[model samples]
Target: MNLDELAKKQSGSIPGYELVDYYEAAFPVYRVIVIVAILTEQNLPVVQEYILKMLDCGLNNIGDIGGFLGLSNEIIEDSLVPLTQQELVLSYLEGNSLKFSITEKGKDVMESLKVKKPTITSLPIVFDALTGSLEPHKTGLAKAKEVKDLEIPIIKPYLNKPMLEDIEFNDVRKLIKRMQKENTDIAPPPGELLDIIEVEKAWLEYKRLKVFVFYSAKEDDVMVQVFERTQRAPEYETRLLRMEREGIRVLRTVKKQSVRNGLLVENLSFNNEDLKSNEESIQEAEERVKILTKNLAEAEEEKTDQTSIHTIKRQLEEARRQLEIFQKGDRVLSTYEHRPILEQALKNAQNRVLIISPWIERGGMDDDLLALIRAALTRKVEIHIGYGISDERSSNDTYPVKKLKEYLSKSFGKYLKLHKLGNTHEKVLVCDEKFAVVTSFNWLSFKGDPNRGFRRETGLYTQNPVTIKNIIEDTLKRFNEASC
Candidate 1:
């Protein structure tokens, strides 16, 4: 499974958090050369074994031994130096002829070499970057060049510069025992760990892993979960947290700085246009209200028929209501304000409500929100919804949408329209011509869970007639486009 699937699995455990986003990140993997002593067998060379056996059989002369072993006398003399120095062989002059003999030590050595023998030998071992555990040397680790080419962020270890002195004998011993128990082919035979003679710190490598960042607004905390090979790596998460606490900026910092400035400018330009249109609409609606009020006053002064006066009063009230709808200045809503505004709109809508959000999941469309929808549908309020950010609808949770269709289609299908758009980033909610909200908040995918950590989401809540009309028209256009 991919990071998305892994994030979903992780979501259930995070009580009040939602999976906002995930990204590719890396952990430092270092290649360390550790000189370790292990218990292993050392075998005698074939030629040496033959010479020793020959000497034991009373072949004292080099010529006789070499002849039997199918080697020249010169070769026999060269091989004899080590044996002699090791005290396994003795050289003597017998009747002016050089001869060789196997010592008692040589007999013991020969016998011991035949069976598995424990020997102290230095070997290079690798240290795990995440757990700081010892492991066999591995190849195919991602190099700095490969990691640089990737667009992901890299989480540098708190101890950036690792030294060989950090490796200890006990760590190596435990690793060897574990490997032996597991019957790993690469592990040395079971034996005691000798002193760690030397450690050579090699170049740092990187292992790409997935990271899911969760925000808890209530606690004002950020929780990070890391994954390697589709499994949670809590040790790595701890490392990241430690780095951050040590004044080292990590994933969150990188993500913040990576936002493109050009996109911000484009969004600002669009918002400015909406603001200008709202101002013009407000001015015109104010003028219309003034004219209606003046007409109602003139009719009262003329003492018109009771029916005509009553009609004028009703018209004047409608004009004032329309003016009020446009005069309530637009507002900037925070993450906390989105829910109540959306719910209020749903509850108070008289004619229609239009919502456009990219995703629909249980997190946003909980039982409460679903009930509100049901009430709106029961009132015969026209509800149009547009969702989906990918070409395939399967990318989203289909079960919720399916259930909605199955439950409401029979009775309210005519009034409820669910349009799966090919792709959209727009988060909008419009209630008839009364008010509308346009923001970064995902209205259908996030329900402003109080237990969730803070996410910096803001929306423009507007009662301006022109802005509301534009949003509603644009939303319905998208719905029509998607249906095509």
Candidate 2:
């Protein structure tokens, strides 16, 4: 997409900006120079060729301006219309039929354009327009090829369509990791870290899905090895191997509770507050779900009340109906995806973000940093927390922690629950409903000095761990943070 069009997309709508729009806009403008340069250098046939050639060198390969290869007098004449003049390459002769040279101001134009290339572009386009290595289809192709030789011959051709139509599946950890890598600037203070984190969040929904999903049948936009529809039985040995795999899958257990099981106690929740909107739904099916929880049915009654959540003496006496699952197994954590644990936790940390620690204090996220939270809230992202730190003994009891919590509520329009613990303990931060931010940052470090502080800071990401994505995320969440 073009610059103006992408900018309009970003400024015009807050909620409706598509993922492509976001990526395109976040992309830098200088990156476009690469595309322009390639075309111009190659003497390719395209209008961009002229634009790139002029920008790269004063001379142009095509569309003569004067005696030298530069923008022709004809192109400048076209600019008289309602064309945007924010950043342009103008080629005009000082004398009649004379030589062409770029003015200092025009050179400045090139520099400025190079610097702010994608300010007006989409975030998604940055990868393509600049980096040149975004192959979303590769993963999809890999998925299709995962299963070998087995094929169904009896099924109809019409039934072999792929399952996912959109790109960016539920792999939140992978993309979040990408963002973290993009923001590798050294930390000026904790505020810088918080700001980058918030930016990732502000645009989280935009990248909620980057991993594309394609049907097995068509080998078009996405790559796929084979797709067929049939239910033919495999050999006895094959069936035995499949059974063994299922047996191993059972060994990887996680506690997935049912709504009936009140064992789960959510540290943070909407609890029916007057808070404004957020990108995703705020209410969770249950604060703590039962282990081995499956597609349990939701109550026909709307989940409008808070006390009604855990207040129930028993599980839904009888769920309207059960969702389908091959086995009613406990939540399973994966050993292979140990790295993605933290990322998954952070990615899933929406709706209500909770940070728990024994020593809590104020000024966690600075002014510029806090503003990003408001921006996120304007986009409907909620940041909530509960920290365990008593203000009774500090120089001024409740001074630091109180100040920290207050700033969170005031600046970000988020409610941060402050819990003073009369006992010593560990640190933790739970995000949204599905993820938790368990860390070692003390309550005082909320805004304490990062260099020399009493804070024994550490933490990791955890998944209720069932899906491979979740398994990987929970591990990485902690690993990445520890590395930092």
Give, for candidate 2, the lowest lDDT window spanning 10 residues.
Answer: 32-41
Off by over 4 Å in 2: 1-348, 362-369, 395-416, 422-424, 443-458, 465-484
Candidate 1's C-alpha runs over 4 A off are 14-21, 32-43, 58-77, 81-131, 135-141, 169-201, 215-219, 253-484
**lDDT by residue for model 1 (1-484), tens:** 7544565466545877644445567677777765666555457777888889899999999889988988998899888987898788999998998888899989987887542334555455665565676666666568877765442466665454446567766777877787778876666656777566666556677777887767665776777888876888898788777776776766532121111121211322235566567657766776777787888788889987889888878877887787666646674554445667788888999989998877786545656777898889889899888887775543244445765676455677677888877677677888889888777777876522223333456567767676666666667767877862
Model 1 residue 323 CA deviation (Å) reads: 41
lDDT of each: 0.68, 0.29
lDDT of 2 by residue, 1-484 (tens): 3222332223322233211111100111111111100001112223333344454575532345333444465653343111123233434555554333444544554444431121111122112211222222111121112211111011111111111221122222243345445563321111111111111111100111111011121221211111111111123213223433554210111121122111122322222222221111111222223311332323224553555544342343222122111012222221112113333333444555444444433223223333443454544555433333344434223444434445556645444333333433444444454544333333223323223312212233333433323423443343333311
Per-candidate TM vs. native?
Answer: 0.45, 0.22
TM-score of 2: 0.22
Report the Cα RMSD per candidate.
20.8, 24.1
